[model samples]
Target: MDTSSIVILDFGSQYTQLIARRIREQNVFSVVLPCTAKIDEIQAQNPLAIILSGGPCSVYDADAPPADPEVLNLGLPVLGICYGLQFITHHLGGKVSPAPRREYGHAEVELIDRANPLFSEIPANIHVWMSHGDEALELPPGFHLTAKTANAVAGIANPERRIWAVQFHPEVHHTKQGSALLRNFLFSIVGAKPDWTPGHFIQSTVTAIRKKVGSGHAICALSGGVDSSVAAVLVNQAIGGQLTCVFVNNGVLRRDEFQKVQRNMRDNLGLNLVAVDASERFLAKLAGVTDPETKRKIIGNEFIAVFDDEAHRIAKQTGGVDWLVQGTLYPDVIESSSVKGPSQTIKSHHNVGGLPETMKLKLIEPLRDLFKDEVRRIGRDLHMPDDILQRQPFPGPGLAVRILGEVTPERVALLQEADDIVVAEIKAAGLYQQIWQSFAVLLPVKSVGVMGDQRTYAYTCAIRAVHSEDGMTADWVPLPYEVLKTISSRIVNEVRGINRVVYDITSKPPGTIEWE
Candidate 1:
């Protein structure tokens, strides 16, 4: 283990990624691996410190995930979290059992050993975020209690062996001084340096990509969103003419998206972009599909088919296209599947899981381990345009998911107009950058409305706006009345075949960001 890196072992906790994110916020590099990772795998990063993430399983469960016991003897500084604390206790000849009063939310932990470097500059009693059912009942040999809450052992340490642990999560904002606690561990205890920056990442990644793709041809599936656009550029920088970017019009994109993206990527970014028009074919496939999942499957399947045809065509021209570059970010990986046994995934990412299983090309995902914010930093450092860098996330199925029912050429055009107006008003009001997603959904149900003294029935338009850190969870944005009025008035007054407008007021738990 070196002094520049940190390795976080995932024990199936959803917060494992958050732990990695928190450490990276300090400009130090950290990587996440499953708890089942071998000792040599952990040593591969030459990490300066190791973090054991909290998980859902009890320490005594039959299927409880296990860390290599050999990891404890590596002589590296170790910090164990909730389930982590229990794991260390169970492994080191200590007792771990169900807590009489399980802590699942906010609690207070009183620091008893104020002189301990782990608690240095922290308050005597601090509020922390807790989520666990088990607790350490007895300290392991050579371990000493450093802090305690009302009902459980809150903190423990063995400075001689350089191991520390806490029962509460220090990566969440609810913990108040959580950032400070993590910083203390990163700098004061582990003696790590702040050397991982945007320039550092780009330089290292380019070199790595170049070496990996030596004298090979690659093609990028560019969606023109922040993720794919950045990924395309990074790959282009690695192997200039050996890369081809394929942008397909799937018949459901936003207004002027095809043209705008082509111009920006080819003219502005200097990418070898190949624009494909398969609108008629995509629209034909989605003619009468209404079920949300069915629509996603059809679109995803059709997209892969089109991309496969394109890859083959390009391969014949360039001798070969051996690699497929995707913008698969960390959250996409987490949401698509389990980090380990204890982590629960909401749904398979349509962007990732929907890919056909028979594709033969190898994948080159440079941004696989990065967060969305970190990708934006790299984009800015690479001198990518603000329009591409600041654009909100667009779904893989495009307007097929936004439109609630059957997709057709006419419906797509109408929805595009309404969606365009909603976006324009949001951007005009200077809320585009502030809002996570603001778009219009065309509904199948229609209502009667008086238009210039003539009664008419038309499709209803629903406006959706949400704010989110990542697409995993979101809250509906409460747009101002004036902005809503402008959007509704414009959609009804200017765009024909639309009578009424509505706003979605539900959050992520009860309702997803998209209506479908």
Candidate 2:
């Protein structure tokens, strides 16, 4: 065993990654492996404990994913959650049956064994999130029921065998005792220590980069947003003067984004930054290209070409650098996993991916595994400015996505003006921090209206604001009616764009906040 790590086996559950997050919160490192992982691979990882994640499928289903029997026989502490509990019980000669009434929400759990390590410090009856359709009728030999709910057994433990199982989800906030229960299992029952932290991560990455680069230089594509800026700072800290940052202004950014970004790069972070004005090139290429997907593809391709040309120029001038750095995050990696599948072909991601293999430079991505909130925390720890760290997320494709149909210099200017008004009004109302994402969308259709006794016809605008912990799921924020009225009136009167304005009220399941 590595004596420092845990392995979470994913069974295609939405909360599988949450299990790993919870483990990391305890300071113990964790990795998610496919449930069909080989016995040899599991052994090679030498995990201190193995956690099986819940899945959508019932254990009795014909094609349900199963765990390797060799994993159970390795004498390591094992914890099974939700469907995982059913799988363990069924594999060990126990009985499982579909529930007559499936439990799907909050439930009260009572711990029968007060002395049990997993329930020692917790209360007797605690709230837990339960989502399951199957229940275990009986436990395997040597295992005894440790906890129960009003309807069925809630948990089981075999102390001698170092195995435990729970039918409830302990990784969600809806379960008040979830964190405590997981801490007990990871620390008390399995004897794992918490050592994962940003410091450890920074040191490890520095060591890895040193070994990989061996005094070579690298270049960064800084977009002035949180992601690329933070990435540049991290790489600069690691490699010192060997890293150069290149910031491009494609003429589609928000009001004054370019200037503020330059000040940030030069003054605060003290990076060797190159400011390239490619607005003319981008505007030329985007002329008459109205399709959203087409705009994204052209922008992505142009961004690569620009960066490549700059990198080659710098390399030629500075003895030939050997690496490229980017600010790709964990969610970006997860969503882009199926690049060759139908999903990738249909969806348009603003970030640039699929870098050329023909380029001689190797790649360095330090923030690949971090969530957005975690990235913000790292930036704070590094003493980055609050304005840059808390800045709203803007798509790499910029105002192009905000414009529904056509791409033109005039249209870009109009959208930028309207977007500026939205940002300014939201900030004045002190609601910027409360909202996860807020932006203005420009519509191609125009409405007729009169301003100061003059007839005017311009593009319509839509206000989109959403609240989310993670971008994966979100709910539209319900701004005060007065605030909405104020914003709508100001945009129509101040900006010369559109006549009509509307607010998007759709939730994430039915609608994504982004119009494109």
Candidate 3:
């Protein structure tokens, strides 16, 4: 079945991606486009509905981005969010001005007209997350006030025109009935079908891979993480013997990761696998590269070089390979490309845009359109081991970025030991599954500490543990004091390089999950 979709017009809002994720949660595909996207670009998705995302800018600003006025005439259900509501009011001959009292957090909206389809089954009084300074003082000609809060008009709607606007963020988790409100708009207003599923994705993806590969030899860059492993398994299932998997040990892996992954691929996955120990080559190029982007680029280029060499060797052994498989995910693509509005390049993902331009093999990314959780579901459907499916996300550059300075064999060894302790302690505390990513970073600076009666100086290690639904946003995990103590003590006492241990308490907005 063709997946029904919704189009989310991003107005440079931080929560725009969350809006897309929420719609996808309802089993309807959602694509994000810039608010300035042309009318033709908006219609190309054949979306059942269009949603305007909230933004930081006001509608009255001289440089404020505007959607094509023709979008409202598209005859599709349209739901405008915070800034979206202000845009609708300002553009449709309604009055919009700065609210008498700005609403920045949670607020309650009383339904003034609950009969509207947008609030079909929602309660009369709903708590919502509000983050806006502008207020829609008057409704457009055909619109009526459907909801209101103490500070401003909460919502306005025109059932006949299938248009609705809300002055609060329904995409964030703070909004109590946000999901239900979105469901009403998606199913009741837009009449979209919920047909997207992991099972359906697996069947369709396998079929697609077979049709594209068509008995051609394919080489998969296996990182031993869930994404790449799942991609490798899916491709192997599609074209059994035509697939050859290459596992590169870049010398930046976690403690004992290379051997564990190599054994698992050989004994458990049972795929035709080859392990390349190019740690020295990678470490050599990464030497004295302190800049994070430069390190990422170096690692990326070296990876492609290793893969190219392997591809040539494999070709001589078994004809020629035509495809290079990667486990690139949706966030990687979105972050790497300006696909959804004017997005900042957060970081360059190793698998997404990191491939060298000179590569000759055709690319096959089976999991490119999927999120991490969705990829996990596909892995489970493929009967992958629970450990592999639930493993925490690791960067392709491995500990190179985590070291936060020049790469060296000694620093890599120190980090590996400290990182292993973190995992061991977290697993022992039974908090491994609850945490999204938990690891230890080896900071370059050394701190003084007392060992018995003697003073010692060693590298300081920082521990980071975060809780997140998706990797896009995260909160630092409030770990039990005892767990923290255990990890700190273990790292300082057992590991040779870490004298002091500190926890990262910052969240995603001001601080990224990684120190680098």
Candidate 4:
């Protein structure tokens, strides 16, 4: 279970986690450490290799972040990326100059030494993703410039000392042969072993949970999403029947999702369950809330109020509980960090900010350090039913975000009906397992349409479906025309007030998963 091959020091790079993903894809275990990680902590990990991630700030900035110098002195193999490369060059007495013409994307790299360790297996000429304003102007002593692009030095290597740096990102897929290049650096140069798996993580988390919540009861908020369900089952394994699950049917949930999730939990995991029907309360609070932020705030605060009241009452009925378990994952941490440079705060996670500050319960986050795929594996290990394990991630605010305008009971019902039809059709077509996320959105705008020779002004429902690995970056899934036709037909026929159903083909840069 102690499989540590590569240690990636995050320098506020947006693609820092992607480097770890690539390493894991090669079956080599890797861990991400903050750039500010202590020298002792780095040494404690005993990494076979190190990769310095790219950052956003200039090296001359007063508070510009840099990796601890001791990380380089560890006498282990190292690879530096983008800002990481510049930092390495500047740290080792090389020169970094601000480029008058900054390189942003798609630079061709010409390899100077085909025999170099980093380029050993990779081709001599390749394309790399470039996004830096500063370029290395000079190489340090004993270091040889091993690659060049049209603009400046693209790569540097000191074979005598196992050090290498690249101005372009080898982590992103835009860089051709990136995996092969990283594999050469990890396996051929650093000699790393591939040994990380979900079973190991499950055992580690179970041990941690047992130690943290010994003889104490815990309550988990079951949103019927993969993350929460997996976290619930894992925590359930640790504390057995002491864990009480609260499934809140906020009015914003997908059509009949409450009943479906209830069945899943009972027939699947068989844990202590309390189904709270608080839809009317949520709908009442959400009425007339047009702004997205206000809707989120209102829904989040209301959800906690209902759940907290239920938990307090449950405690009085049964016994006292100590921990409020959550399914907080790793991406939530990285996306929330103030240190991630130039990264846009996509949306505030409700479960993260929903809890009241004065709540006295301790937290048991079993999936705190995990990713989506890792959560799925833990679900599989816990023998959770496939229905729960394969369910797409649903926001804690549910369909509240999917509705573009005010959260009304009528709109919520319409959206739920449309969403259920889409989900059921996808499941029937055997395409549910292939898509990462699929949902219905109730756009605020109403359009003119004619049904049975009667002109009517009705809401336009947009269907969003995308295929992604981790929900970070995604492309719209090219659903078959037949499947789309079926979903559209069902939505228009079954869901009242929806005159039209349109598929959203826009990707993440222009549109988010949720309509709001």
Candidate 5:
């Protein structure tokens, strides 16, 4: 289906994925490419319009990133945001300078031209979220300022060339009519139609997978989480009996997760699932690895090794296995493959940075373009059970990352017990679905406490619960004090190792959902 889509040039903005999500919500398809993407790559998507994402860089920097000069001359409608706005201005004969005062929070924007299509139905005075250190001090040739704040230009437009730019982030929830603004740009200006949906995605993906892996067997790393589960099932739908799913038990899974997931895959989903107990092997390799990155690399390499061994065995039994399917989401791709964006590598995802160069099988990532919620929608459309669809987001590296220090049996057991209690309590409080990701991280530090009137030193556990639309950005869940009290009390009393419990109050900007 030749769908009308938008091409989002990623400048490593934290909100770049949010912009794509907003466009998809309008039932229009969108894809994100790196800022350094060649002009041909941008044109290959046949985008109806191009959107330049906001980033954490100033256009006037010594090594400032710039889009392809050819993109400006493509004659396609371009919308620049934040750093993107500055880039468009500075590159096209306009002046950009550092703001005297950086705007970092909510600010009111007044529409100077009420007739502008981008601000079609928007009110005169509206609030927007701003995060920038530089501003487009002067408009480019043929550009008119359409909106302004008290101290800076909020928006500029060149109606003749169909170029638009905004200083504030319209994709974030802090903006009242952000979606409306995007809709105006997508529909009113670019003439795009809302035609994308989960059902359409499922049908198209099935066909694509079938065409990609024809007559060849494929192996999927099934963690039984929503992302992997959906990927496994979708591929199974495409090539039945040709897909062998390897579920590796890395000694860091939640309590009874392996057994339950095994049963579900075998009976519920009817996948060709193989459960590999490589826990001891993984633990032995990670014996004294204290560094988080090292632990991740060990786990990642071990996972691939196990998968390779299993694949060889399967190939011996069958003919051969040529592909490895993963449930890698867009955030993982964006964070891992950030080429020109200022977005820093927060943490290495196992499925991403952990893969070995020597691995023989090619990767098939169906959900690479989708977010967490979008994957859930596709799972629902496939009639997956609520339990599978609502499973909490688990890292591919498993509990190895959850345990702050060394990945060992003792630490894994302690973290698993504490994590199990956290989940059980959250489910008991009827807040499981309301929260995005809730897990327990076993801190490396130990504290002294009196247990049964005897002084003892034991591990301390940190509980993290966050509210997020997608895992791209999150805020700590403002759990009720009573809920917090219950969780803390339960973890300390029920879990044997932990002496104390602490809750993470940091948001995604300063902290990630996972401690590692």
Candidate 6:
């Protein structure tokens, strides 16, 4: 089925993806293209509307990002965000210059044109989140003012041209009416219908997958994580018995994750799953590897090797396997690279399994266009257990990335124990679902501590918990003092090797979620 898409042109803004996310939340599909996209490229989506994303550049600056002015001449309903507004005004015979006092945070917008469909039924005064330094001093040709702040223009419109633009961001939560404003643009202005649902997605994706993999069998590397697990199930629905799901134990998984994932995939979910205990195999390859990148490579190569062998065996049974299903999400596709900006759209899902080139298998990424939350909705529609859909995000290398130093079996066991305690404590406090990730890291440096009146030098366990809508940005979660105390005391008393437990409070800007 042909879907109505709203095309968003990227102008190098940090909030560009957020604009796409907001539109997708409305059940009207949207696509993002770099600002450098040609006019015909913008036309290729058959866009119902064109959204210009906010960027960090100024129109008058010599180094400002490139844009196709012809995009406005296409006669599509146009909505411009922060930099988008300035870009439109500057290109259409309007004056744009630095504001006397820049608006960088929350501001109040007073709607002047109440009858405009873009502001239909919205309150006259609204609290909006602003981040622009430039202000429109004069109206563009045929454009009239629709809204304004005390210091700057907030909204403008040229109804005959079917274009509207806003100075404040309508995609962020800081603006209380952000969603409502976007809802107005999508429905009242652009006439988009909310037809994108999980059920619709499942039906469409299954049809597409079946059409692509007609006579060829597809094999999935199921990590037991939600992304892979959901991908495996979606593929199974398409190919039935032809899809073989392989779950390999890389030895660095969380405590009992191997058996737990096995139960969920095989006994509970009824997938034709093949479980391989390559724990010993992977641990040996990572034996003394300490550098994070080296450990990651060794683990990834070993996984590819293990999965390849399994694929070869399965191929022999099914005549041949021709596709590899991956649980790649849209965020992975968005942030995978840069095209002279914060991000550029990645054309393909990063090989989820890092399979060898010789395998010559085609890629089937059912969830590549979806966000994590959207994937969960599809999982629910498929009747997948909450345990599988709600599982926290885990790194590709699993606990190897959690452990700061050597990848030894003993350290793995120690971190797993401490990690389990951290999760258990968080869950007991009813914080498991609220927090993004709650895990323990095994630090390489151990400190001296008194245990049972004996001085002991043991490994230090660092407890890390974070809050984020996506893993791309996160803030350290301040688990309650009591909860932290419980996690710390339990790790010290229960885990034999760890004498000290510390909490990580770093956010994503200066530090990543993981220690490595």
Q: Each candidate's TM vs. the true structure? A: 0.96, 0.93, 0.90, 0.89, 0.88, 0.94
Report lDDT (Cα) of residue 400, candidate 2: 85
Task: Please give the clash total of every predicted structure, in order.
Answer: 1, 2, 0, 0, 0, 0
Clashing pairs in 6: none
Global lDDT of each model? Answer: 0.89, 0.83, 0.87, 0.83, 0.87, 0.88
Tens digits of per-residue lDDT, candidate 5, 255-316, equal 89989999999898899999999889999999989898898888888887887788789988
CA deviation > 4 Å runs, candidate 6: 337-353
Candidate 4's TM-score: 0.89
From the highest lDDT down, the ranking of the candidates is: 1, 6, 5, 3, 4, 2
For candidate 2, give the lDDT of residue 130: 95
> Which residue pairs overlap in candidate 5's backbone?
none
- For every candidate in turn, the CA RMSD to the true structure comes to 2.1, 2.5, 2.9, 2.9, 3.2, 2.6
Best by lDDT: 1
Question: Which of the predicted structures, 1 or 6, would earn the higher TM-score when compared with the native?
Answer: 1
lDDT of 6 by residue, 1-516 (tens): 266699998887788788998999999998888888788777787789999989888899999877878888889899999999999999999999999989998999999998998887789999999999889999799999999999989999998999999999999999888889899999988899999899989999999999999989989989888999999999899889989999999999999999999999988788999999999999999987888878877888888889999999999999999999888888767665333544432111223456788899899999988988999999999999998898888888889988987889999999999999988888899999899988999999889999878999999988889999887689998789999999999999999999999888999867888777
Report the poorest 10 consecutive residues by lDDT, candidate 2.
337-346
What C-alpha lDDT, on a 0 to 100 scale, does residue 72 get in candidate 1? 80
Clashing pairs in 1: 2-46
Q: For model 2, state the Cα shift of residue 424 in Å.
A: 1.7
Q: Write the per-residue lDDT of candidate 4 for residues 1-516, one digit (tens) a residue.
A: 244658888888889989978887777777788888888777677688889999998776788885577777788988999988888788888888898779998989999888887887677899889999998988888888889988888889887678998889999999987888898898789987766677777787788888888887888888888888888888887778888999998888887778888988877678788999999998989888899888888888888898888888888876787889888987766655536656556676687445765667888877766777777877888888888888877777788999998888888888888888888888898988899998888898899988789997899999889988887678998999999999998877777799998989999877777766
Residue 45 displacement in candidate 5 (angstroms): 1.0
Off by over 4 Å in 1: 1-4, 334-348, 352-359
Better of 4 and 6 by lDDT: 6
Q: Would you give me the overall lDDT of model 5?
A: 0.87
